[model samples]
Target: MTAPQRARSAQPALDRVDRRILDHLADHGRSSIADLAEAVSISASSAQRRLRRLESEEVVRGYRAVLDPIAVDRGLVVHLAVTLVDHTTNTVGRFERHVLDLAGLVSCHHVTGDVDYLMRVDVADVEALDVLLRRTLARLPGVARLTTMVATSAVVDRVTQV
Candidate 1:
């Protein structure tokens, strides 16, 4: 099966109330149960119950502080189109495991395309990216080739809305 197809097939359906809770939570991750209840027009206990359900179901993965990358100095974003030396399962698994230990790896997707994987990397600058590509990614096992595209600007970066 295609990678996108697999992702689409795995999404669980959410009801109206569940969607409302998610929307509110997306806007305010640190919102109290009482506050969420008020926003969603439900009782505190009910909101708590639904929140628990969302967590258990993996609908709400985890809460995190979304900081400005530029402010922290890791502003440069690069999307790498990577081709593997082989299409073997072992090679793919090894590559995946190895990239996890890499410092600049933002996200990696095993994709169905000319390239075996697409990786998003964030670094402090072009020099840092050059070092990453040379010292880290290029030397990784099973990496046949890599094409890097620097993102000049992010037109849209958002969480999935309910």
Candidate 2:
């Protein structure tokens, strides 16, 4: 998966210690305070305090274990570009609400393009995808069109440190 492009305005300046801490955590979220402190050349207590501050400030949101889709029986992954017939707020809200209800939807983004929304969906096979497209997505009110493209492979899937 490609990293979501972040706006430059949303980023804040990082001190050297902050950079080091982030780099260490990026390499291993399970790293203990002592290990992180040693890597960053700081006291364990200091490292713990810094970590707490980062979490409190929403810099470190949460940790997750990355899983293989095939192992989980959800191998077929597709990207869908959706365009709504109406651009009204109510219509968009209704569509978004319905999209959120679908089980296969992994991520949805309101983007700039011919399509108003981009959705990432994962299913077991093409049959499930057809059901999702015809029954769920196509049935959405005010939906003009939806274009889907299956992903063959993920080239880079890394979260930026900092």
Candidate 3:
């Protein structure tokens, strides 16, 4: 099956309350149910039920602590444009599997345009990036070429939709 088909089949639709809970979490993951209820304008019990339902449905995957990459010493942020030599299902699958296994690859999106894939990568330095390119990315089966753009500043990186 295609990637989009596989993703859609795995994930279920979100209800209104579920969406509100998700939005609340996206804005502030540590927000209590009482606060969340106040924000969503629902009773505390109702908010609890909605949050439980969202969790059970996998709509609310898991909560995580967002950290500063630079503070943690992972200073380099690279956006990579990856073009595959082949677009067949097998080739795409192989590339996807390999990309998923790579440690420095933060996010990978199968995108349209000249490039087949867009990858967000993070590393300690340029040396680490070189190692990632040579040892990890280059070893992938169908990768034809990769072009990288390093981010100098983060203008906006919002987790929640507004």
**Per-residue lDDT of model 1, residues 1-162, tens digit only:** 999999888877788999999999887999999999999999999999999989998999999777778776678988999999998999988999899988867789999979998988889899999999999999999999999999888887552221
Better of 2 and 3 by lDDT: 3
- How big is the positional error of residue 159 in model 1, measured in Å on the Cα after superposition? 7.0
> Who is ahead in TM-score, 1 or 3?
1
Minimum summed lDDT over a 10-residue window in model 3 is located at 153-162
For candidate 1, the clash count comes to: 0
Model 1, poorest ten-residue lDDT window? 153-162
TM-score of each: 0.82, 0.81, 0.81
Q: Backbone collision count in every prediction?
A: 0, 0, 0
What shift in Å separates residue 84 of candidate 2 from its native position after superposition? 0.6
**Cα misplacement distance, residue 55 of candidate 2 (Å):** 0.5
- Regions of model 1 farther than 4 Å from truth: 1-13, 159-162
lDDT of 2 by residue, 102-143 (tens): 886789999997999998888888998888888888999879
- Rank all candidate structures by their TM-score, best first, as comma-separated numbers: 1, 2, 3
Model 3 per-residue lDDT at 15: 75
